[model samples]
Target: MLIRFKSPVAADVLMLGDNAQQLLRLVGREGQLKGIFEVDDQPHIIELLDAAVAAEAQAAEAAADAGGKAPARPLVSLRQRVWPLREMLHQAHRERVAVVWGV
Candidate 1:
């Protein structure tokens, strides 16, 4: 299972794999593989957290704009949101999801 980011903020991470050459070769050969890899170099954890925060904020704002009552609490608290991203990275690593070289 490859993990691709919609943004290119993660390209720097491509350098961290022990098999960079093979990973790059695989990534280059398959368009589907390319879609799973993030071009952004940032750590997946940070990027994921940032994305989640942004998404949550957008959702909250949209709900407010639609005249729906903003939640008395955040839709997902910061703590609740942080772990999944890290867990995903860990799972991806353990599963060899993308031959991840970068953190």
Candidate 2:
């Protein structure tokens, strides 16, 4: 179950179901198979996503620094996972395009 986000402003962004749900919740959206994001919501969502990515990176770094085997090697760094969404959101905000998941 992959979530594919589509918009006129950019190419589709795909995520695994779990990753997609996590992102949806992270962005304060309904974590459902299908949902819509209004153009006006993109900026705030992007902001939150940015914060989440930073937080995750910091956590991973801390764990590594503690000799906890984190190694700064996240199997799925939120930054990498969330980047396409950010790109899509930025494009949507600039173009007034709506983004949809599971379309």
Candidate 3:
């Protein structure tokens, strides 16, 4: 299924099942499908997403650093995938708007 995150301050962002779940988890919204972010949760969600992205990048870098005969499995890094959600969340917070996924 595709999830659409809508906010008044930015363009709508659509994500597929896996990608949507990834964003939900990164922003600590795994259980959320549609809802408004609490004022206090906006910054916190952004922080969590940032940390998750950084951690994934670090892990990918570590795997790359382990240069040897064993080829490292290619992983889909979050940088590109999460950009829209991150931006949406930032805009949501800035505009004091709500973001909803689905319908």
- Candidate No. with top TM-score: 2
lDDT of 1: 0.44
lDDT tens string, model 3, 5-93? 78778899988877888778776668666666665577887788888889877776777789644445446557778788888888888
Clash counts for all predictions: 15, 0, 0
lDDT score, candidate 2, position 31: 57
Give the Cα error of residue 80 in candidate 1, in Å. 9.4
lDDT (C-alpha) at residue 29 in model 1: 31
The per-model lDDT (C-alpha) reads 0.44, 0.87, 0.76
Model 3 spans > 4 angstroms off: 68-76
**Cα lDDT for residue 25, model 2?**
88
Once fitted onto the true fold, the runs of candidate 2 whose alpha carbons sit more than 4 angstroms away are 65-72
Best candidate per lDDT, number?
Answer: 2
Candidate structures ordered by lDDT, highest first: 2, 3, 1
Cα displacement (Å) at residue 98, model 2: 0.7
- lDDT, residue 66, model 3: 91
